[model samples]
Target: MGVGDVKRRIAEILREVTDEVWARVAWVAVDLTKELIRTGRRKIAVLADDVFQAIGLHKAVAYVKGLLGLIEYPPRSVDVVVAVVATSEGLTRREIGRHRWASHRPIWNMPRDGFIQLYGQIPGGKPPFEEVWRATGGNSKLLGELYKAGWSAEKALREIADERKITAFVKTLRDEERELLRRAVDDPDVLFTREDIPLMERLADLNLIVDALPERDPWFWAGEPPPERDPELGIGRHIAWQTPLHREAVRRALGG
Candidate 1:
């Protein structure tokens, strides 16, 4: 979808999923105020992905002030469009430099170290912009794609990958989100949701995990491990722990 459509869709989705509509409505009011300042009542909407890419410190303040000043009265449904751009491919240098908005400024060309310092001036967490740029060989779009696929710094170092999308993707998720995914992959029945299957399918697309079973049951796969009991501690539960070596062997078997 285009940027505007993406933003609108995210807003709509957020509203749909929100149990507390009033809280979200309040935020929308703030967003509308910002919109007025930035676009002079032409309808204010910010693409989430683009904000991560282009909106610098100075511009973000101006955008916020503009929006806040626009709202005279608070009790209303304010439309705050948030577009989270989740992609599979890492971004290219050119992609990062691309300006989708008319008022946005060109990225300043600074030495690597200096630019890192410049990034510190911006708010929010350190998004690994410089690190990803350097890691992906300066391909920003490709970097974004890797993020969408649940790949990590360690995994990225070991593989070359691409970008594709599932029908519905959550753009607001972050790198640490993989922990939840890992849990779901291990035990899918934990908490079921429509998004769970689509994301799981996407992981399968990345080839990080596969679906298969051995042709025949071998000794190890045939039965559970032996249970042990301690004399002092009677009838303690038998823990099943796969050692790193055993895990590696299984990984090799699985074509890791």
Candidate 2:
């Protein structure tokens, strides 16, 4: 079906469930959010924040417009706000993104799980899904970068290592950050130390690294004293290369 057809279908379905009450009035509010998400073109958190604002403005509009028209304001918009309010209260971004509110939102189509779930979605996804998951850490932007590589570990690594954007980003890095990347060339999971704190923050700002988990340290180190989880090393939050390809790319750029 065409996009218009899909939208009409959704509107019809909602109309049926709206019981001719306030829900019809809510159509505009939801449309506002859909437009912002489609046009604002932001990350998940920023999108969610915008959705919150859109819903608020929608509420004020519905109230004033209804008062002016001498019509009873709909209660359905309140239901929508309930969803956004829940997010503001404490819901994780993933949890909020999974709400029914996203039935027509593009966030659902984003690479939340990367190839772990999308390997079957796209044709010719030959590389192991596990490898892609490890390499990109489910980061949508990074996954887009490697999409042309078509799922081979070697190809993904090669693409990252040769990607112009990757090289340009590396060139912008400081010598200390480059040194960190060179060290992670083969040791992507190296536990960041207190000493590497500044460098880790610098790399994370560029999406080259991500917070991992303590369990990823090593089984052999099980008997060793667990390193103190310090905020400096992002303790309680494991730190590592966002993608193995990123590690290799930076490493190669540093002439490791």
TM-score, every prediction: 0.21, 0.41
Residue 198 local lDDT, model 2: 61
Candidate 1 residues 28-107, lDDT tens each?
54554454445434334443323312334334444444333344332344454332222121132123324443122222
Worst 10 residues of 2 by lDDT: 82-91
Query: How well does candidate 2 match the true structure, expressed as C-alpha RMSD?
Result: 13.3
User: Top TM-score: which candidate number?
Assistant: 2
Q: What lDDT would candidate 2 get against the real structure?
A: 0.46
Task: Kindly provide the TM-score of model 1 when superposed on the true structure, using C-alpha atoms.
Answer: 0.21
Which predicted model would earn the best lDDT?
2
| Model 2 Cα lDDT, one tens digit per residue, 69-98 | 221222222222222221221113233434
Worst 10 residues of 1 by lDDT: 233-242
Assess each prediction's global lDDT (C-alpha) against the native: 0.35, 0.46
